[model samples]
Every structure is written in structure tokens, then in C-alpha cells.
Target: MSVKPQSASAPFAGPFALGTLAAADGPAFPALVDSEEQVLDLRTALDDPALTMRDLLERWPAVLPRLRALVADPGAVRRPLADFRVLAPVEPRQVFQSGANYRQHVIDLHVAHRAPDDERPEEERRAEAAEIMDRRAAEDLPYVFIGLPSAITGPYDDVTLPAWAKKPDWELELAVVIGRPAYQVSAEEALEYVAGYTIANDLTDRATVFRRDMPQIGTDWLRSKNAPGFTPLGPWIVPTESVTDTGDLRLTLKLNGEVMQDESTKDMIFDVARMVSYASQSTQLLPGDLVLTGSPAGNGMHWGRLLRDGDVMDASITGLGAQRTRCLAEES
Candidate 1:
């Protein structure tokens, strides 16, 4: 099947991004999205109507050059992005999330959740937290936890705020998409396994984060972070080559048009390479898996303003696209 050439200009000049989009009359399919909000149906472009994002990643070495060629010289019919509903870029079989990996975010959490009976000055507490962070950076490994892929949602999807969640919050993160299989890989070689980068808003219910009922059991990530639609995954995935500097990318999240979290990836205690390498030590990383780098400082808890019904979150990572998610009250 040959793709018909188009007279309209190409959507982008260089490296392209990938996404999942569905027209009103069809099922969701993998697509190539351009910077100008245009889309080329990947299934149609590649002449394989059954192609998925996972299929491309699994065979990335061969597919990469073809994708680059397709981007440069169009052979497919292009359509306006508004003609379809965007979905989560990829449906990973396993999702690994790094927690407390941002130095300042950890300190912010410490300050925000100070012991009620403690009488220390705020500045003194902050200093202590900072010192602890420094020590942890030098001595600790990345704190990784498993996240259910069932929680994944589209970039523009409306997330239902669970009735029982009193302190729902946003955590915008830079998500690394794995292309090559990796097992116990070194940090230096970890990036070679990366397929691309995308955005994820790791919504959490602060009230459920710590199991107060059983303090000894500690944090309950499954209950606090894995609600359906809690993770707004992507607008698109920008290939690794497109991102020049992963270490310095800026992450910005705006709540109701006001900037809530704005920080750089440089603040991460464990960078992307380290996070991916650490996770690979325990389990083999496969194509289409996601490695979520921890969120930076400035969550709702720190601002004393948790999520409520009708709140809109606009999250973006440098080089990767942005995602706008709205919050709705769960129906009784």
C-alpha cells in the first residue's frame, strides 16, 4: 500500500513525535504528530494498518531511520490534529515510577509535613532537610515503585476525583520510554535503551499516601496513586535524539492558569540515566515500558491547595509536549 503524497506543507522540519489518535469514526491508532498540531496516520504512512507504538519501539533500530525519512519526505496524507481525539501515546505493560528523586521536592515535602509537636524554627527545619538531601544523594539509590498501567489516561482526558480522596494533588514528571531491552545496564549505557520522552502527571491523593491506620506499613502507593485516569500520560513522544539535554529540561505545571510547579530536571537527585539503570537492576526493561522521573518541588500540599472538582492542570516538560487534564467530581 503506497501513501499518496500531499500538496500541503509538512508539519515539521526535522525529528517528529509519535502519538495515538482516533478519528470520530475509527478506533485509536498510532500516529506521527508534528510540532504544528498536524498528524500523519502512522498505520497508513508505513503501509501497515495494524502498527502500534509498541511495535515501532520493539523494532526501533530498523524503524527509526524509516520514521526520520518519512518525516523529511512525506508519503502520507496529513490531517489537522483537531480532526481526532488524542489518546495516551503508548500503553506500557509495566510502569516504573521514581519517588523522592528530586532534592528540592523532598525538602519541600519535609517542610510541609512537619511533625505537629516539633518546635523548631522553619529555617532550621529547612536546613536540616537540605543536609539530609545532600547525604541521601550521595548514599542512596533511586526510590522506584510500580504503577499500574490501568491508571493511564489521555493528555486531555477529564480525571475523576475520587469521592474519598480529600487531598488529591498533581505531580508532573518526565517519562522515559524504553525502546531496547535492558537488564542490569550501567547508567552510562541506559540512555541507549531509551526510545523517547513524554510527559506524565502522576496524580496522587495525599490523604492516602501514608497509611495512618497502620504507620508501620508506611506508604500505600497503589491506593494513593493508581486510581483510573490518575496518570495523564502524553500528547506525544519526542524521540530521544530530538532532546539535546535531558539533564536540563524544564518542567512546568500550571493549575487553573497559575504556575504551581516550575523547576528544571537538574534538580533531580537521581538523573534519568541513574533512575533507569536502577530500575533495570531488579527487572528487565522492555520496549514500551515507562520510567517516570520524580516530580520537582511545588505540589499542591506545599501550597496548601489540593485539587478539587473542575480544576485544570496544564503540565509540560521541555522538548516533550504538554498535557492539559481537567478534574471532575466522581459520580456517586
Candidate 2:
């Protein structure tokens, strides 16, 4: 599950920094952007023990220049990549999750739970969804739910399956890392608040999504999604400048090396800018807030599969590095 270090002879040009892993004493340091390297022995790039990636985001304008300079300098400290353990890029203060934003994913769910109707054809139902999707895009409102930061875990950490969860599933999403304050901003100006992007697997407990006892309350995402290790995030963050297009990146998840979810951000009913702008209406997105762009189709439920103990999920977004998560069952 490891890769070779970047060749010393040919190093890529500067302007990117987002990898972080635990050091011998404490807080993870930024990994080098020097070519395609997996060696962590490069030494601590940022020596601030009290600082986390959240701090970096707050001071992005300053840290970014330091990152670029570090990458270009040849004699910077480095250690063996295998020595350090990976950590989530940032421990965000607030997390906003967009729901029902993927067109095809919603259609798939509708088809699965469709009622028996003699008059209307299946095609008619799909057409209706498409129309609704168009209206949603046109409308300024976007649906978002609040999530606890405690649910966050390292990109490669194992997800602990609670005993209460009957059917656990994976929802791989593109997570937008907020770098600046945003309040009631327009969609046209939302991207300016982003620091970078990372991969997120929003694990949900399907069976517990709704409380049958209180059907009137609707979906319960907290129980269904905020388990100890529900949100697996980041090998590192890819700076916004490095990402040329957020609307067209491909997101894919492989379970045990078998591709399950494969779709592009192009299918999103509300793109990243819209989601951020929508969230900022009521919430003041601070320096390390996160907006999880809803996941696309091909979830395990749609594929007649659900996660179990010993299962592995390898998720990746174009440009952003990959994440590996192993699913484990909880014991009494």
C-alpha cells in the first residue's frame, strides 16, 4: 500500500502544500510538494507545535508563500516517509454537509422505493426528477446539514461500525476546505473563500437514517452519519490554485480494489460555489470550516451491496491524493 519516492534528479515546480502526518513529539507537519514523493523523512517543515492545518488556513496568505519556498529549497529537512503516520489535513471547527445534490444518485433511490402505479411509466418518474433537479439548480436555496467535527478521522483510519448499525454504507464526496470568512456571499464569489479540496467518505447507517417511531421528524443524519469514524478525510489538501476546475473533477471509490462509485462533479445539482454561498446565508464559515459536496451515484445500496467488517474503501478525487479506510466491527 506504498509508493516510491520522487526522483531527486527531477522535482516538480513550487506552489502546492497540504500533506500532514504525526511527528515524534506532536502535531503533523506539512509534507513536501517536491515531485511525486512518499518519503516523510524530509523533516518538519512547520515547527509550530500548537498549530494545526486550521491555523494554516487562517493564515493561508502567509503560510502559502512559506510552503512554496520550502518546496523549492533543496536542503530542507526530510525523514523516511514510512516513519510518520498520516492525519486528517485539518480538524475543522464546523462541518456542513450538502444532501440530495447529486442528480443520478437521487433518481436511483427513487426508482428503488417507487410505489406501484399502473398509469405512470418509469420513464415518467425519471423525467419528473430531472425537472425538479433543473428547478433546484435555478433556485438559490441549497440543502445542507450540520455535522460534528468529532466524527472526523484520518484518511487511512479504520471506520468503527457501531452495533446499532444494521447497514453501513459509503458516500464518497468532494470536500471544500474553507480558508476565509464567508457570510451571505453570492455564488459567483464563493470560490474566493476556499483554501483547497480534499476527499471525504461520508459513511452513513442506512437502517438508522430515519426513526420509524417518529416518522414525522424525517431523516436523522447525526445517528446515521456522525459515528466516531464516520467521516474519513484527507491525505492532504490540494491548493485551490492547483485545481483548475472544480466542476469537472472525477470522484471514484474502490471497495477492496473494485470500483463502486465513479462519477464527475459535472453531475452535481449544486456545484461547490453554490453550496458555499448557500451555507454562508446563515452560518459564518470561518477559517477551517468544511462543505461536503454531495456524493454522486453508485453507492453500495444502489449496487445491492453494503459495507461489512474487513472491507476496504480506497477513495480519490482528481488531483487530490487518495484515501484508504478499513471497516471494522465493534465488539461488546
Candidate 3:
């Protein structure tokens, strides 16, 4: 299955991006993908068969120059990208997910999801939500949560909607990949630790988001968002230098050919640097760790539409490439 090449307005800023790919006869290996959708086998180009994406990221400062040289004059024979199966670009040791970080998204949820007894005017509810969001952005830190790395799946893989997940939904987001150790970093210096950017669809089981049995404890992120294949990540990692503005990229997610979520990174209450800096305050973020900025407005819940079997999600972020994931019902 050959993959399609990026159009004239390619999302990647650099001539090439790093990815993980596997041929039918071989194990997964690090690769370099060009705009034409041709892949250079990095394992062979670097002459280190054991090298992984994590290894490159850990030594990014050193590896970057070498990668650039290879792209300039790739003497090695390149293969069609479709010849190999694309996998998640990196295997993160830790995943930090920001929640309610997008301004309009929060407002949309606030207006759409109301108490059954409440009968406020639509405009009134919207105005009140907007005011609350403004205050939260000014006074509160980003709301972040931990996600299991085990939930990650390939960009084009099939996601099994668990039988118990009655209200499955899609949340396409911009993911920040860490290049260096970051602890107690300030927002001003946070971008220096970034390795690159990727796309992640943080699928959720809305029905299980809130723990009814224990309202005091609140959200059950593990059960609601960490199911296997819940996080469909990456066709490749676009270097941070490739992105001109981390705070101004477009994020769009389409379900079964219908546009559902369409918004820009500018709508985010907490930008990439702020989100990473906030996460670093408590945890020592290592190389390859992923910090997912919150998804923008237009989730399934907002449209009163939920995921069903055989639904396909095409999610993309500006210049970071796209992911195509198919939804399947868990077998009985």
C-alpha cells in the first residue's frame, strides 16, 4: 500500500522528516522521509542497524547535522514509503496530556454540555463560559494529566472501540516531542528542549470520563483515554525549526469524510511552551517524552455525533503531516 506524497504546501518545513517504518520481511527501523514520500533507511545510511528514533532524539544535537548531510546527498538507495508500514514516530517513555487548554474548545464544551435542569439562554451561557476561560487563562496553570505510553498506535492503524465505551470521540492535537532533560524550566526557555512536532489523535471514551461512583475523585483518565490504540500518533516528526510559529498552526480532524473539528493553535489558552514548562515543573521530562497540547474545538460531543464501527478519522496539523485511523468495534 503506497502512501501519498504531500502537496505543494507540504506541512514539513525541512526537506526530510524522521519516522519509523517496517518492510514485510524486516523489523521496524528508523527512516528519513522526504516530500516525495520516499524513505531512506536510516539504519543502513548510518550503518547502525540497532538505532531507534529514541536513540536519535537522545543524541539530537549530534545526530541532526548528520541527518542533514544525508538528506543533502542520499547516496543510499531510497525505497517507496508505501513499501513499509509506518509506525508511531517515537516510543515515548512518558506522555503528558494537557486538558481544557484550548480556549474555544472549552467554551464549546461548556455551552454544549449543560445540566439537564439548567435553562439559561444560549448567549448567556456562552458569555459566562468565555469569562471563566479568560480568568482561568490569567490565573490558573494548565490542567495536565498523565497518559500511558502503551496506548499509542501507528498513525494508520485500526483502533478497537471497547465494548463498554459507548461514547467514543476523537481529539486531534499537536504533540511536542522533547529533545533534552527539562526540569523546572521557564516558558521562555522551554522551546529549547523541544525536538520536533507530531500529530496525535487523543481518542476518548466520554462515557467513562467522569467517575460517577466517586464524583469527588473526578476524571478517570486512565480508563477514559488510555485504552490500547487510543492515541494514534505520527506519520513522522517535523523538526521544531520547520514550524515558523508553534502557536499559529491549523488543526483539523475529519470523520468519515465529514469535517468535524477545524481550528487553529492560536485558540489554545496555553501554548506549547507554557504547557511544556508547566509539565516540567513537577516531572523531569526526558528525551522523546511527548507533551500533547489540548485539542481544538469541534469534537464529536459538540456535534452530537459519536464514533461508531467502521468510522475513519483523518487528522492533521499544519506542516506536521496527517494520520488516518479506522475505528472498529471490539469483538465479543
What is candidate 3's lDDT per residue for 1-332, written digit by digit as tens?
22233332235667889899888888999999887778898888888889999988999888888888888885767988768788899999999998998898899889888899989999999999999999998898999999999999988888999999999999999999999999999999999999999999999999999998998999999999999999999988988888889979999888888999889898999889999999999999999999999998898888889999989888888888888888889999
Q: Candidate 1 versus the native: TM-score?
A: 0.93
Q: Which ten residues in a row have the lowest lDDT in candidate 2?
A: 4-13
* Per-model TM-score on C-alpha atoms: 0.93, 0.90, 0.94
Candidate 3 wrongly placed segments (more than 4 Å): 1-11, 114-120
lDDT of each: 0.87, 0.80, 0.89
Q: In lDDT terms, how accurate is model 1?
A: 0.87
lDDT tens string, model 1, 1-332?
A: 11111212223223679989888789989988776667888888888889988998899988888888876775567888878887899999999998998888899788878999989999999999999999988898889999999999988888999999989999999999999999999999999999988899999999999989899999999999999999998878888889888899999999988999999999999989999999999999999999999999889988999999888887877777677788998989
- Each model's backbone clash number: 0, 11, 1
lDDT for 138 in candidate 1 is 88
Model 2, span 1-332: residue lDDT tens: 22221221122122554667765576566565445454432234677646566777898777777777776766776555556667787889999998888889887777667777635778988888778788878874778999989999988777889999999999999999999999999999999999888889999999999989998999999899999989998876788988889889888899988999999999998989989999999979998789999999989888889999889888888878778888888986
Candidate 1 residue-wise lDDT at 2? 10
Model 1 weakest 10-residue run by lDDT: 1-10
